[model samples]
Target chain A: MANTETALKDVMSSIDGAIGVALVDYNSGMALGTLGGSAELDLNVAAAGNTDVVRAKVRAIELLNLKEAIEDILISLNTQYHLIRPLTGRSGKGLFLYLALDRSRANLAMARHQLKRIEAELEV
Target chain B: MKRTLRQFTGRRPPVLIDPELLAGPGLLDELSGLRARVPHLTGSLVATTDGLVVAHDTRGLEPSGVAALTAAALGVGARLAEATGQGEFRELLTRGELGYTATYAAGSFVVLTLLAGPDANIGRLHLEARRAGRRIAELSDAVLARQDRD
Candidate 1:
């Protein structure tokens, strides 16, 4: 059972081109744990703000009546890829794993695959 | 589409109907019933995914604010479920030192929020609230369809 802090450290250390990572509680719009953010990219704010993005997509899916679950929501920016993966574990409900990756060096497909693995290993 | 759904529903000089009017009382009944069934239930409310209040049985706390915040929490919770490969959102529960706040998806666009004292029975809460959430969804969905007809 990977704890929240170690699980986040694992994400940062193992994920290539990782700019930052955060474990966010969407229920309160707060980051339970965060690491590796730069001045330009505040993990706390990014994690908090992405809560809205996730919510918007959920609403969109419902409004459109598209009956499918989101695997992850990826925001591909000019120089960054912001990945939001909601944790599936029993203790992790109402929270998500947020990772900001540098587009130039990060492999999107591989990053997605790894995030999924890390999510399963995460206890909360 | 939403505006069109809010229409007049009765006889000549038809009365303007709040969409909730179709299901609000039923929703309220469900909320109150849950409170009565579960001891220490401080309050309960249902809201649209957009944060609009549908029905509530809360006290002291403002229903509108709670509704808005519930929408916000629902978003993240739903997304979190999606990310983790959970098929769909079922329910979310949070425990505070003083009490517990639980949310269950009523449908695609509605949620039921409940508050219980610290001493409240968590297991019973889930069993009861889950049932109430489903009924709320049915009630809300029926309202939505009714609005479309109006």
Candidate 2:
């Protein structure tokens, strides 16, 4: 299986305008691997922070009794786009790829497309 | 080992209920009514913060388990919002392969959760669900308050 580092690297480079990326575990609120974060934007903190978002969504789904798998979660902001792609592969369950992109520099549609592709390729 | 034991023996918060209110099926009926109003809604439920099912209209689903999971998620959501200075926890929505699941904080100790088909109008779902959740919260609180007074 490809390692978390390589998967994270691929995410940061392949997505245009990527400011930071992390492979996060929603259950524990930890980042398994991270890349491209700035001093002001810590990927570790972001990873931990987004864990809540993922867990919350999952819980809601369970409560609602919807029989489906989550594709991805998109949070748009004034200056950025935060994309959370939950890894659904056999080995990647409970893990997610968090990508932060500059709104002005990134193409939202392309970013989603690329992230989906990357998620498919991600081994762990 | 200690942690595991603690988990097993953890003190669960008591469920706030008004026997008089729940003796009938009013809450469940209300939830069913909400489902009818939202064309795409597949199911709906009201659960305690500790994940105990109070009322539900979901089909083929285990209400107690879902409520517990919702409580876990709510803990994380509330902390996440507070830590990030995003304000109080209000709602959560997850879009899935087959459809959407949405949850709203109904009141201090309850949550309202809904399921919708893929074709459901998101804006409309949010609008209707929010209104229904608020009403449910008020009804629940009133029931509890009156019981306490008596």
Cα deviation of A56 in candidate 2 (Å)?
Answer: 33
Provide the clash count, candidate 1.
Answer: 0
For model 2, the stretches where C-alpha displacement exceeds 4 angstroms are A1-124, B1-24
User: Cα deviation in Å at residue A30, candidate 1?
Assistant: 27
Instruction: State fnat for each of the candidate structures.
Output: 0.00, 0.00
Q: How much does each candidate deviate at the interface, measured as C-alpha RMSD after superposition?
A: 12.4, 12.3
Superposed Cα deviation of residue A28, candidate 2 (Å): 31
- Model 1, B1-150: lDDT tens digits are 122111111111133335366445677789889988876789998876667787889889999999889867777776677678775667789899999999887754677899988766565677678888778777766766666686
Name the best candidate (by lDDT).
1
| Candidate 1 to native Cα RMSD, angstroms | 16.7
Compute each candidate's TM-score over C-alphas: 0.48, 0.48
Which candidate wins on DockQ?
Answer: 2
